[model samples]
Target: MIEGGALVKNGHIQQQLNQQVPDASDWLALSLLPRLGAGRLKQWHHERRAWPQQWLEALSVPQRHYFLYLRHPQGHGQVLQPMLDWCTAESSRALLHPDHPAWPALLNELPDPPLVLWAWGNLACLEQPAIAIVGSRHPSSAGRHHAQAFARALAEAGSCIVSGMALGIDAQAHEGALSAEGATIAVVGSGLDHTYPRQHRSLQQRILNAGGLLLSEHPPATEARPAFFPRRNRIITGLSRGVLVVEAALRSGSLISARLALEQNRDVFALPGALEASLSAGCHALIRQGATLVTTPTDIIEELGGPWRASSIQGAENRPACREGGERQRAGHDPQAQRWLVLLRDGAVSLDELVLRSGCSVSDTLNALLALELAGQVVMCGNGWTLSAPSSESGAQTR
Candidate 1:
């Protein structure tokens, strides 16, 4: 398997991550090399494998010279040092090698995937189904609402909302997902160490605290730039199954993401606006060009199937948000939550009692409870579980 380093030759690749790795500094150095895009590096690495160390030896004379310059004291370790220090300083901060378990494998579907990802917060979020919501940096009021509402609904439906954490619609999307206690990921242009809008500094912390992720291909301390944002749009689309455009002018970056999504064979969804709304023009044009027209979360959800179609927490508003990221991760996509509720028809029951009633393991019984609790289908009542608010008479629950 390409992921596991067992070559399955259809022009196969082996990821020898566990064998031996280059110095963190060296890997970073390779990434920063001039004229070396991630696409070329990945193709080369897969063609011949020993790890990044060998790749350095294989570089052209000039590339090698530049690599040495990065290591030189005068050449400004400014970019590398802060990035490395941040990763070293915190257990949560990580430079995710392509072979890392937490890497967003969906990105690999892209023509050119990132070599590594600078990730902050729960890496588990990367494995979840994600829908990218992108739009104009200066969206209209309605556009902002659409971005947030759709994001919240999609998140509640168990799809992570992916976006660039910019000033307008992107930020709103992140906030909406947070509001629903749903997972979200921000594929940012700026390095993980700094915020672009600066206004979003607090929003950044809230994402980490809420189990969402902040990701960057750039090293830490790399501030935002106009060119960086567009380059990073590919990553935002690459990580998602679909890209949603809430509102965008013809010239907007959100449109670029949609284009990349199409090129990557990912679904593109657009929320069409009024005939006269300039911001809606991009979305309308996209729809005319065969992008899916989405009016509600259900439209996007039904289009992007799999786990997204699975029964999840009921209403976004009713459920108590998961208090911890780990607990939420474990609770995801558990079809057994409904089955657990059937066993609890008699009334409130302790974990031991539920285990006895359902003839399941203690671990299973506990997991069911957490899922139900998160769904607002059940609540903890004095160390036991019972059905929660708006008591259903039919006793049926959404998956």
Candidate 2:
């Protein structure tokens, strides 16, 4: 058992430390050393049997000369200590290194996977099929809605929703899945013990409570640094079977994840958005450059094929009913709600026709329709509100 300030058990920090297999502490210590990185570490790990000490010894001559010329007094050995301490401290927090048996095999396939992963919640969830949903951190209302709704639908179909767990789109994506009482996985850039953006603490707890997993590559006490995010993005794509870009600016990190996905041979899907919107430029570029264009969960399922079939799309279409009546019943009911349900049963009806058929005043019908939408019972496609597949009525009643 490893005991340190980092070891958290049932919310209590443990004080005793024990030697563990693979000594992730040692790996973390090496990784944190100045001038040492995944590339260099791999070089050493792959080239020599007596690598660790041998590599350190080889750098001594050049390292000392460079330090003296630069008038910096830090020695190579001295710089390595803090990283070692970091590893030891992190071990107490349930953070595991790549050497751990619990580490997901998918991560190893990346060209430069994190040497260590800081995981919170159940580790087993990593084995399940996962789809990564990424988009603008400041997504528009529609973008946020789509992100969450898509994630929820995918989650309901027995796939885990994976995202970077940022604000806006990322938060909604996780919420969407949780709203459906489904599993989600949040891959963060900060340490497991630290939740960035502070506002998401409550959301983070909800995720854990709902059996979702939160993961990070940074050690405890590590703040949100600029460079840590791109590395984090890689893990987001690496862990999933495919990556979905919902809404992003041309230079957004979401696009980087898509690139990484392609490099890693994972499918990339982009949601087409308004051509005039700058926020959607990245997605459009991806689509134009060969990424699959996804308009619904069905599009995603069809692209992935196999278990992710058109039936999965039908399943997603049916989810609205389960969601409307689930433990977290939708917010409110209105005349439009009943009308929308009826129209959905009748299949895609024009707005004008819907008003005529539902028999409600046009103004009242529109208002009710909007209310039903907030409840997730209806979705607007083209010029009409298509009844979301999973109607709330019982099967016999629907028939």
Please give, for residues 38-122, the per-residue lDDT of candidate 2 as tens digits. 7655555556435233444544454423422222123324543443455456333345666677778787678887777777776
Give lDDT: candidate 2, residue 182: 76
Cα error, candidate 2, residue 57 (Å): 5.7
* Clash totals in order: 3, 7
Report the number of the highest-lDDT candidate.
1
* Residue-by-residue lDDT tens digits, candidate 1, 213-306: 9999888778888899888999999888999999999988888899999999999999877788798899999999999998666677777777
Query: For each candidate, C-alpha RMSD in Å?
Result: 13.7, 9.5
Superposed Cα deviation of residue 188, candidate 1 (Å): 1.5
- RMSD of candidate 1 to true structure, Å: 13.7
Question: What is the overall TM-score of model 1 with all chains considered together?
Answer: 0.71
Local error of candidate 2 at residue 269 (angstroms): 0.3
**What TM-score does candidate 2 reach?**
0.71
